[model samples]
Target: MKYLFNLPDFPDSSFVMQITFWTGKQILFKNDALVEQSGEKGKPFLIPDGNGKVVKAYPKPSLPDFAPILIINGEKHRIVAKLPWYQLVLALLPLLLLYGGALGGGAGAIAAMLNMQVFRNEDSAAVKYFKVIGITVAAFAVYFLLVTAIYSVIA
Candidate 1:
């Protein structure tokens, strides 16, 4: 999924920012042309402005708040518009189920993948629900498999 945001307006400038979900690729465009891009996620990268002056850009995490931030030149900007309530539920759903224990860690990893996709806007409501449910089931399967393996080893 991709999230797009309009950069703060500048004189004779038509800068639009594009961010790809999961991979966290950020691209800056001016006048509908690609100017700069970076694949750094949760890290800073430099891009040249319309004036040919370099500015810093960083991609922040996409969880808990569901508000992914893209900081440019010491200013904060949201890459995605509109935070859906379902995203919040998906982000916190794993926490409610997987808390503490070895099995929890394995399940939590699966949940993390789900959390990543949950933020993507491309999926329909029904599709998103199925993803959440499927991931939850996969987590349980991992937990059970781990338990069975551990039990057999102990026996």
Candidate 2:
């Protein structure tokens, strides 16, 4: 989603991370370029106070405790880039391809199993994203069954 915000810690008094339609959807990083949920997420949200500090000249809001201040312009904003179902489909796509390949040839199944390594919520961002999707638990079920079935058949 396009965002016009700023990080909390900055050298200059005024620094903003402005995003527009041309820039496309971008994620604002708090402390670094890559924002991993596990890492310490400094204040990185925006709230338009429209008061003294906020009204005067874009007071470069400090990142709020919560991240990703969505819908700032008073106009309802739809999530442009978030797709929880799509992630599940994407993660499962490769496996589906592997399943097809393995079904065709046992080697493909083995290769798929080897490649599709399911970890236990190692990536905090992934966990959070999945949790937001409301399909993490269900996704795990399908993932377990699919992987185990493939392995059971091949091994």
Q: RMSD, each candidate, Å?
A: 4.7, 15.2
| Tens digits of lDDT, candidate 2, 75-153 | 3222222335544343333333344443433333322222222221236766645443333334445556777898999
What TM-score should be assigned to candidate 1?
0.64
Q: For residues 1-155, could you state the per-residue lDDT of candidate 1 as single tens digits?
A: 44445667344555565556446566666567776545456456555666767666776765554346767767877666544676656655665446547577757655855665575657887887777777767776777788889889999
In angstroms, the error of model 2 at 101 is 24
Candidate no. 2 TM-score: 0.19
- Please give the clash total of every predicted structure, in order: 0, 3
> What TM-score do all the candidates reach, one by one?
0.64, 0.19
Off by over 4 Å in 1: 1-5, 9-43, 62-68
Task: Write down the lDDT that model 1 would get.
Answer: 0.63
What lDDT does the true structure give each of the candidates?
A: 0.63, 0.35
* lDDT computed for candidate 2: 0.35
Which residue pairs collide, candidate 2?
A: 43-63, 44-63, 45-64
